[model samples]
Target: MSNNVVPAIINLDVKGPVISRHLYGHFAEHLGRCIYGGFYVGEDSDLPNEGGIRLDVVEALRALDIPNLRWPGGCFADEYHWMDGIGPKDERPAMVNTHWGNVEENNHFGTHEFMALCELLGADPYVSGNVGSGTVREMSDWVEYLTREGDSPMVRLRKANGREEPWRVPFWGLGNEAWGCGGNMTAQQYAAEARRFGTYCRDHGDNKLYRVAAGANSFDLAWTETLMKQLGELGCAYRPTGYMQALSVHYYTVSGPWRDKGDATVFGTDDYYRTMLQAARVDELLTGHSNVMDCYDPGKNVGLVLDEWGTWWNVEPGTNPGFLYQQNTLRDALVASLHFDVFHRHADRLVMANIAQTVNVLQAMILTDPDSGALVLTPTYHVFEMNKGHQDAASLRVDLPSGVPTREVESKELATVSVSASRKDGRVLVSLSNLDAGQAADVELDLRGGAVTGVSARILTAGELQTHNTPDAPDAVAPRAHDQVTATASGLRVHLPAHSFVTVEAALA
Candidate 1:
């Protein structure tokens, strides 16, 4: 630690936007074991099952209070056909997942199964409709099957299939990555298609749908500009019956190019620093995309949905390369904390964001080993679990004193510390991360509006940057009670360890 470097002071004011619970959302694709072996172990499996869904995974996810879960994919959603996955598990048609591992998808976990899993986790289901290889009628009927109550063809089919009551699916994605895997269409083409698909995706009774249009890929400002401009023009000229409620963006932190995304667990300090810098680019991406959105929708009518954001790395050695199965480490915890801070800072425009996956995938929350019946919660999971208090809480404006640690690597500026705070139920919850891999931070809080009487915290840190939990060592990197927080006369004081994520809850004096 530099003696000349001043301690970071976080000033929190109560007047700010309310952090959306949806911001802490998660994503699940049909890739690898994320759905099959990760969450669903089949009804007949001896390893604890709830109608085929893994009970341990459900219990862990429920504990995190996961707000929403986007289902069936990254690129998989655009290729999925809702009809083939319904009816009976044994009779469902099997298709090759060309986008992912090229493995055969048995279609066992369909709409009903996903809804049942959501019910088990107490999470809202955000279904991504197939627009690339599917029809508008197909998309409409899928929505009707899940939300429609009255007599309809889809409703009748749904009832005949066994579920009498319609599941409340409020969030629907029009497409996923339309510019790439989703038909490779131009922005104008996708915008028109989005309008068409969204028009027929009706709201059943009180189930108002929040339709999210497939948005830009990372820093592709041109894609965002073209889509928003085309949508605006369409609305003005044709006065479209249905419009986009949100524009979805996808960004992942990779250490290198597409082919060589570095390793998930084996990395040094420099690699960790570089990864943090890449994750920090999310702020720039959000800023650029939001600025483009402001041009088309000044009132911010349509929110920016970061439906897919997390660290993507090379697959674990010896695993199927296409599976995208990787281990999560403390480095991932820092990345998650940094991203969450950025989301809260831009909560007004950034309505929702889902981490890349929930389990047995990129930056997964839970790692399941069915062979051994071992379920491991990653450091990333502990970050989400600790920061759960921020859900639906009113965001507090935080002003950090200048002179915070900043590094310039590869022409990018990365901050060593990331912070976000919120007030809910008369308790102020602050989440902080020390991105520095070498030095701990003595951070001081300058609270406004009221004095803090008591302080309690949970911290997730490891002795090494690559520290992670394996099946045999599941408790290796779990969160522990933070005893470094103490109430100060002015506000509160916290000792933030190096490369650590901490969540502190303070009660007003």
Candidate 2:
């Protein structure tokens, strides 16, 4: 720690972009039961499924107030042939999933199923197009199929497929991780291809498409620079119509080591530190990529989309590792809350983001039984539910007077305090997760221009750090309404619990 220097103060700046509720978005990929047994079935399942989409799952997601949903693939979207999904179900060609588990894709949950599911949840749809192994016509037609209302071949096919009205898909991705799973294409190649495909991506009357070019792998600033150079405002550039909306980036937290991902359900001081250390990278990737984008377009012409991000780890043992289904713990709750704070703080340059998988996949929210009608809420879900107040609210920068130490997870020197602010329905909501495990922090909030009248917190913590929900002990770790909060004379003093994450809502009088 520094003797003279104090903790950095975060300013709300009075005003900023209204945090889009969509920023608290989620993702669903074809990997694992994330699709087949997770969100969809054969429409004949006994486990409360509708049109193959699970009913309980939809209702649960709705409870989280999910704003937008990215679909089809993490790696799956790159090779996704959107056509095979439409038309008929039985006759649909069977495709093999090479990147993920090599399970033969039945193409049951195609475009129609996905759009309809999105409609059921009332969430905006974010579709990742195929740039790795797909063509421009295929990608363009997909936009038309979902958006165009008139007599285009794609639209006609869509109408015949079951949906009469266009979904008005608002978000579109040019590609998914082209540097890796997508196609192993160079940044320059993907950028040029992005322009070519993005140029022709027309929006049908009702549907407004925000085309995002495939972004760099992780910390590839060179790729971002090259892509920007090609875009150089190119004289009248794209179109009177919006050609490109955002440049995308994908990053996952693979802590300590990847080969030995350790236990997904285990947590200790070390686990907490490693998790926060890795999770904090969201902030790094944003600024690093943002700097590169600014060099090319100083005007901030393009939005940076963290389309895919979350804690990555070894899949549950006995489960197909390739499916990426893992357990979630209170540590995951803190990670989720902290990541949301990152996005809120960087809401300007970052217009949109989606957690990798919503259910039954990487750091998923809901874990369901493939056979039984049972479902368990993961710590990630509670984080989303608790921090939902930040949705669509203007971000107010928050600063703490002191710093904390992360002694457990190898970041013992200095640990960053996780905090983000948003105003909703006249109340200022501050979601804070102290990275320090088992050590509570006294947060003296200077609610400038506001008075702290009351505080309510919903916290997720457990008796044991590694305690998790198994089939038999599903409720072992869950969030409970907490009460160690009170208003103070100077501002407000709230005792944040140790190894716990809380969403504290302050009433500004």
Candidate 3:
């Protein structure tokens, strides 16, 4: 370890955009066990449930105070038919889930179940309407079915399915990935389709829909440019409209190429560092997409939604290849922390980001065992819980004056530390991550502008980078009370361990 301590500054007076609580959102797709076994174990199961929804899963996710949950898919949303999933569970027709394993989907958990799940979690619903195979009327009727009142046909159908009142679906996704799985359409094609489809998705009374068009595939700037060129302007005024309020992007952190994304728990320091490097690329991705959006909407009216993101690794051994189930480790937690740091930095343009999935899938917060219905909160979950205080908080400017710590790996320099801060209610929350695998460092936070009365903190790290929680040892990589931070004269001095993520909560005067 170097004797020279790294210095970072956080000016409490420098107020930035409100880090949308929606930025700390989650995704739950119908793929894999993310739905059927992970969240819904049937109403008659021994595991306690609320109307077929797992109580344990809901109770666990409730800790994060999750703001919004995007539903029915990455590719599944584009192919899904809402009518098939609603109505009585038994009577609902079954179909082949061609995207994620050729398993039978009984359409058990549909619109009602999802809304019920949202009610259980107190989160807003971000419904992803089908665009690839669904028609304009299909998507329009879905919005009405969930949000409309009075004697409408869609409302009558919703009532017949047992829902009396309307649901507040504030965020709606126009489609998933349009260039690939959503449908192999060109940028120009999807933009036109989105404009047409979005036109019919009415607000339906007080339920205002923020329609998000399926945006770029990673750093595909042309796709974003086309969307802005086509949908960014509404009529001759060139004004922003609710028809296309945001654009969605999907990026996953993988250690290797897509053919083989390295094992989740069987990675060395080199693999870990490479993963961190890939995770850090989100800053570049956001900035690139934001630059394009700036050309059309300089006021930042249209938001950029990183709706699908997180670590994607090969499925667990023996699991279905298409299921995308993987283990979450200390490395995964650090990746999440890194992404949140970048997300905070781009809060002006970035509005919401859902970590690939919430349960039993890629970079899941909670992993459920199919046999016993036991739930193991992954290390990534701790990052969310510890940093929940930053939600809806005013973002604070954090600057590194002593130069960012960097480590050269595989001929590339990787930033070893990431930091972000925010102030909420009279408290300031600072989140930091040390991405180094074997070196601990001392960091002095030169805090200015406000008087901090006292500070308390927590740290999440394990003995190794790959250390993860299993049902047998759930706390293997869980967070513990951190006492390494001392109140210095100007601010606070913190000692960050290798491959660790920490959050500091300070009472401001």
Q: Pick the candidate with the highest TM-score.
A: 3
lDDT of 1 at 1: 27
- What's the distance in Å from true for residue 438, model 1? 0.7
lDDT score of residue 447 within candidate 1? 75
Between candidates 2 and 3, which one is better according to TM-score?
3
Off by over 4 Å in 3: 1-4, 232-238
* Local accuracy by lDDT, each model: 0.87, 0.78, 0.91
TM-score ranking, best first: 3, 1, 2
What TM-score would candidate 3 get against the native?
0.98
lDDT of 2 by residue, 91-177 (tens): 889899987879899999998899889989999989989988899998888888888886878867877877787777888988888
lDDT of the structure predicted as candidate 2? 0.78
Question: Between which residue pairs do clashes occur in model 2?
Answer: 12-397, 73-77, 270-408
Sorted on lDDT, highest at the top, how do the candidates line up?
3, 1, 2
Model 3 RMSD in Å is 1.5
Error of 1 at 196 (Å): 0.8
Q: TM-score of every model?
A: 0.96, 0.93, 0.98
Error of 1 at 55 (Å): 0.8
